[model samples]
Target: MVSSMEFLRVANWVMNQVLVKSCYGVARKIKSHSFDWGDLSYKPLQQPSSFPDIVKCDLEGRGSQTLACDFHKVLLRTRSFFPYFMLVAFEGGSIFRAFLLLCSCPILWILNYEMKLRLMIFISFCGLKVKEMENTSRAVLPKFYLENLNLEAYEVVASVGSRVFFTTMPRVMVEGFLKEYLNADAVIATELHTSGCYFTGFLSKSGLLVKHSALMDYFGDTKPDLGIGNTSLQDQLFISLCKEAYVVMNEGKVMPRNKYPKSLVFHDGRLAFLPTPSATLCMFMWLPIGLVMAIYRIFLGVFLCCKFTMALGAWCGLKLNFKDNNQKKSESDKGVLYVCTHRTLLDPIFLSSGLGRPLTAVTYSLSKVSEFIAPIRTIRLTRDRKEDGETMKRLLGEGDLVVFPEGTTCREPYLLRFSSLFAELADEIVPVAVNVHPSMFYGTTASGLKVLDPFFFFMNPSPKYDIEILEKVPRELTCAGGRSSHEVANHIQKQLGYALGFECTNLTRRDKYMMLAGNEGVVQENKGRRF
Candidate 1:
């Protein structure tokens, strides 16, 4: 039988071989212009400037070239066919290749087009497995399962402190389940997934908060009916709000025996409970890397510092706080959500490497070359909304999560609308503003050849990013409908824009693709055309 350590070593070796070779090989092929993927470029077929439609002329009643107006009317009346006439960057075989690539790498598909699909059914089976494995063990009370949960319940809110409602259904279904099972209208859950959208993933699960919240706030109203969160501070707010608003109060639950808070009390019809915080265990100090990997990391750090400092100026001319300055640093020691504006692929790379610590980055897709030679860890998102959300929560539970909330790199001196998903991940959010300055060559573009991105960036004499690690958005502000994630994202975007003196554009990732790549980044040319 293989020991655990040997198994880990073997697994690491396999990853190094498979990931490194494939990625590097692909990069080399791209460099040589031999193997290219998703190259969508086309010129529209030439036709008469105006096709004299006799039907349109008849509709006009006064036939002096009324066909144009009639043609537009036909387009307007046909809801499904309207989008087909929109500008597209590529057509025919090019579109098929793009679709094929996206399907194979679903995450990339999500990146180019934010269409999230359902996962395979095995996840429901696995959830059953989890239920069976520890059916008897009581779940630690979770947060955010119910909107407008009576804030008077504290102990029950410990595990999950907050939730973002992304859908309309299942409020009835979930409320029914909780009402039937616990005879309560509120459920304090660490996470929640409705049956239809459920997936067997943590980060993907986290996405449900964003998904449902987006749907609920479909009208773009910044103000949302967010309830008090399950954090210690918010629990106190619940007491004050209950007292001030004269909201009817109810007693907090006391699970069978010791499954709940240590104590419960009612002060003047105000509910309070002290759920014991989860305990942490620390063993004797131990090293993370083997002697060999440790030495390699040390040398790698030195080499990176030298190379970036000399050529890229990785950390030079930057205003940052490296100390444990954040009041929530202790909490962040496990994981803090770092929302940053993306400048280039190197943005995550240079920041993580310059910090001289292991900071995992979230991306839409992984390049085997980038992974194998990566200075820091990187993960590709599956784009399953709920799964993504739960995964980020898990990562935060493990360590800090760095996310480029802008969703895509903006080469122009402007910021795009940030994805609110990351903002919903944690209360301890750190906004990171990246200002990239290039000399001799620009390493950024919204529409450019894929092969040249890396090539041009490295060829630059020097590129610098003035990384500003801003103060954390206070937890109180986001609690109790104080600020929705979208609001928080907008605030952050404004803050970053002001700090960098960069213009902020209302254009989103989709808009960028539509304007540049022509069709929401993925379009089939001549999809249904007559020869």
Candidate 2:
């Protein structure tokens, strides 16, 4: 009888061969099948015969109608079955030869079965994809690609992607340059059509929205010659692909010390063409300013720890106003729930100083370091809906609660959806308009680490905050014969937007984080992916 090890190897070979053969069959069927081009809104899809004219974007209607052909339309449609094209074309056309193809596809419908990948961790980091496409009635192929490079010389392939390779702009530039200069046929990229999808596994077929990386791994067994990258850890994967890589620095001129002897770095002062200041030098400039801010924080902490920090904003050049200047502190102090528009961390801190009393602030973005320094009475929100409600109820019973109805801070002139939890907190809901203008270094950001937020804010030269306390809304008026919490929250958000001239967006804290960090929703399993 054959040994178990040999038997398993045989099975693996059979499975791989079968997968490749089946893929060819699918490709053949798809190629012969007539696809419905009418579904797509792009004008190119509607009329392929006009491709030359459409691609040229002719303004004078000079394009010949006879130039239109179905072949260009077919090529566009063929993108949906591009993997099959690549597999057959790359290996000199055959089911047996194409079996050499190696790629990991997200298993379809099966529960933890088939297609395992080493790059799984790398993919999560690129969840948020930045799509850059302009609407035009034309084929957006690389102009150089059409003009140069004979396709028959090498294994010509295209890489279609959304946030995959640390290479979007540079990859396109390199591909174009190579095609022009070397007449090289190797094509690797993330420039994919809207309706293209690459099949990941036997079960996984290409889908329009599927990412290019998920369809297959870009690199084969061969190590890449060289890749260009920025300073992010994710980009490090690309740099390691080559024996020598170009390091592009956005911050300072100092090249980070790397053991790679052949690596070419641009950030160091040696590149006199660009001003890449040393990181050490930047820190030296900040040390003195940071020390001064530390001293001021300690003084502010004393008042906040005691309960209320008085005239806090006035000292920092703050201007406080209200509907009625004659309003008594005692009235506001008596369980008044401050429903404020979201601005920055400085908003609550500065507002408290102006109030002549301390406020138990409910926030989602307080860092531990800032908390230690300021000691403003705060309940850090977990952002869990039910749990937060309980925390707010408990905090509400303590004293006047200051809450930004819009859950997250906005550095720009936009207001996000407010939580209705404030409607239930108290009857005396005072909508306070909190506005902050920083000369430099904003206290709040959509994407910066919370721990460093205070440093950025305090480091600014004279950050000014304005607190405008509006008329209080009673519970009876809010309900108007009993309204839902959502309705009340919506009303407050609309009012704030109208009064402050701030645009309203449905974008939540998650959306902001996605935009800033490309963190696509899934809770990160680890801090960084190690090769």
Candidate 3:
């Protein structure tokens, strides 16, 4: 019985005599003792671009040096040594060659069969990996499968994190990825396939593997240089990913020089503003105070009359501390519309209650669904259907209107798309910004409730109210000809954002007022026309 060591010795001797001579004979030139495979790091092999470096280092190993004359020649020379050595061992009438041949044949057959099974299994797993890689890479992949012989095995160092490696690839695929996407590092993975089942790899700057999972986790990290320069397939993949992140990051870097806060609420409301405190005090103080007294008297009468619902409404108004502008202008000259930045269901109520007026409010269809039975007079705009421009024209052309251009409210202090019905009444926009202090009670309205601190109701409602009327933009600034309603709408929104003290990052003219103001509109201290 031949021991494993003896077999390796015989194999090695034959490999030297036949394979070495047929190939380069460099193995014989160098002393075998000088080669140290154990200490040789595999770093160079990991990079396909470094193949030339491998060839250059071939002189360090006698056996490797002999094997350097192209890979196939060594395989052929080794095959020739096999039969001759077997024949010499068994003599002239030897069946050793035949036995060796038969044994080799079965092993080959079994190996080939097993390899097919493994290949199928591996490919199934690989297909999933490929899909994941494509999703993660956001890059296209090859449409074809690799031949079994062309596939190479490789162990990737990407076990860390969610990263996994698909190291090996057909040379053509490697070449294609590099050429098409300008990836150069792919050549290393392709060269590994010569050994069968090689792993496709990407080297990160930290000398770590940027495999499929890694790419997914860090999609645009491994910046493989795909720019106008010489690079490999792997490099290209890395660079492309890095470039993607670069674009996204750089997008945020550009300063918005032309950005301005929008005036959507004011434009929609048609309420005039005078920033000067004296103007605002003159306009709002007297009328609002007088109205409150009159309302109190009316409330006493209604209570005496046993009109409970009207009393309830009055009570809610008082509780909300509603106050309207005190300035008394003639009805005809009250041409300005109250363009309140819409926030919540409370906004219309807030403005009406605060203003001490029977406001002609506009609401969307969704809001109208629940609000149809409400006593307030309002026009419901269909959210799903196109607006009837003429209907809007009639309303604004004939009467004072209160419009909330901002359609929704959010936590972020920014405006949304503004409504354009007020655009038709462009001659009468009075921008109004209302900010309400965040409520202490969990219950905001009878319809919606959010309880914060359980004991907040006990806290004083003093300093609870904050309503502000900002300086209004004139009709000349608002009304323009030959421009689409959208442009006018956008311009209005921008102005409102500026007036209301918000960054109009994504606001449009038709967005509701509540979105920018949250639940509360900022209260300008002076009642009427603030400059």
Best model per TM-score: 2
Each model's TM-score?
0.39, 0.45, 0.33
Query: What's model 2's TM-score?
Result: 0.45
- lDDT of each structure? 0.40, 0.42, 0.34
Instruction: In model 1, state the lDDT of residue 343.
Output: 77
Q: lDDT-based ranking, best first?
A: 2, 1, 3
Q: Residue 206 of candidate 1: its Cα lDDT?
A: 44
**Could you tell me the lDDT of residue 182 within candidate 1?**
32
Largest lDDT belongs to which candidate? 2
Off by over 4 Å in 2: 1-287, 294-298, 301-334, 520-531
Backbone clash total, candidate 2 = 8
Estimate, for each residue in 1-531, the C-alpha lDDT of model 2 and write its tens digit. 999646544653453344323433353344345422221111211211211212222223322111101111111222112222221222112222222221222121121211121122122112212121110001112221232222211111121111112222213223433343333334443333223332122211332211224212554454443333333343344445543333332222222223111112110000011001121122224335544553554455454433323334234322445333326344443466788987666566666666666788887756666666655687788768789888887777778788987676665567877777777656567778778775434455332345555655554434456677766665565754387777777877777777777767676766655543355333232331110
lDDT of 1 by residue, 307-419 (tens): 33322222221222232224545444567777788877666665665455567788763445445565666787776878988888888888877898777776545788887
How many angstroms is residue 201 displaced in model 3 relative to the true structure, after the best TM-score fit?
42
